[model samples]
Target: MREYIESQLARGRGYFTKEEALAELGLSAEAFQAAIGRVKRKGLLVSPRRGFYLILRPEDRQLGAPDPSRWIDPLMKHLGLDYRISLLRAAAFHGSSHQAAMIFQVIAPKQLPKIAVGRQRVDFLFQTSATFEEANNPAWLSKLKTEAGFAQIAGLELTLLDICRYFHKAAGINGAAQAVHDLGKNANPRILAKAASAYENSAVRRLGYFLERFGHNRQAESLKDFAKKAKSFKALDPAVKPLVAELGLLDEKNPDWMLIINVPVELEA
Candidate 1:
């Protein structure tokens, strides 16, 4: 079993499924399970998902498995799921490295529990297939090369919008603001406006507020027309409880973007 796994690795394949192993080894189900179990016990293989196994090279043993970026493409293909690297993970790739990404973040059509294997962790954020397809414009996605292969990642504009849309998961409003501050330098105003059109108006408003607060006025201006059209005001940080409900005081509102500043945002120099 070890030799077979090694040969597969040699052939440039990093992973295999249980069915493939059973067939290739010509073993009964019970026997194959026992054989694979032994390899796993020896730290030669790690399974991030059921029925799938990743062979660990000597260099990869320290990390317990290959970096998620190295195999995410093939793994997503194996599971028959469409995905793109997104949120904080995608922001880091775009040079918004203010906050280190603690886990790999992915956007997929279906919801999934987090996957943790050794030191590697991956979190999945959900979107409907229709919504994901509509937002996954070719111009907003890019192929990023990794040690094992290439993985699809959100482009600058998409990354910024996704971070705001999922701000709670991306480390709240301040975290989202930090990413905006870092990424704002290279943001293309025209492309950002086009991308914002695909997301909810609230997220567009939050993003615009962050951009203006972080001194990216031009980029903020690009999103102004779209944000101003929002039917209602949205909290700058959706996670914060409304001050109106707590203290019976109206929250400071940014009329330009129509956002209720429910939380304070602090940015680093």
Candidate 2:
């Protein structure tokens, strides 16, 4: 059983389901259960989630965790989820590596339970919008080369917009502002605008505020136009509660864009 599992892993498969193991190991019903139990006891395999077991190399057993990126594809495939890696993880892939990502953030079509791998956390944020469907091309998802194969990650522009759309889940407005400032110059304004359209008006307002502050004038203006058409005012960062008191003197508003600033944002000189 161990040799067979290792052979499959050697062939570049990162993980397997119980059924796959049963057929490949050529074990009788009673024997298959025993084989799995033995391998698991030896730490040769790990079930990151139910019904999914990852093949562990000898070194991996010592470390006690496989690289989540390596096995993420198979796990998602087993669960039947079409997920796109996003946020700081996507930012790193796109060239903004200032902040190390603590969580492996993913956008899934439906709700998914959180997954823990060693010290790393795989968080699945659900998107209910039908219009915000994952794109099938390279324009939307950048390929991440893994031991298994390339994993699909959100594109640079999409990552920037997502950082704003989910600013609260991200590193608040201040951290997000820094990330936007870092990624702004390299990203295409039109692509950013297109991505922003998929989100709510509040997200548009947040994107416009940051883009404008960071010198992406054309992009900021486009997002501002969208914000003007929106019906409500939104805070630049939603996580900072007691909004007005938090900003104090820094609190201000862009009436035209319908955004209430509740935090101080300064771009790098």
Best TM-score among the predictions, by candidate number: 1
Q: List model 2 lDDT by residue over 1-269, tens digit each.
A: 87878778778886888888777777787987788889888878778888788887766765576767787777788888777888878777777667567567888788888887555578888887474573323576787888788787888777877788776667667657877888877777777766776777787678777878778787677676687687776666556647566547335777867877767776345
Residue 179 C-alpha lDDT in model 2: 75
lDDT of 1 by residue, 152-196 (tens): 999998999999999888878888899998998688999999888
User: Residue 197 lDDT in model 2?
Assistant: 67
Q: Which ten residues in a row have the lowest lDDT in candidate 2?
A: 129-138
The lowest-lDDT stretch of 10 consecutive residues in candidate 1 is: 242-251
Predicted structure with the largest lDDT when compared to the true one: 1
Q: For each candidate, what is the lDDT?
A: 0.85, 0.75
> With candidate 1 superimposed using the best TM-score fit, by how many Å does residue 55's alpha carbon deviate from the native?
1.0
TM-scores of the models, in the order given: 0.93, 0.89
Model 1: runs farther than 4 Å from truth? Answer: 243-245
Model 1 residue 116 lDDT score: 89
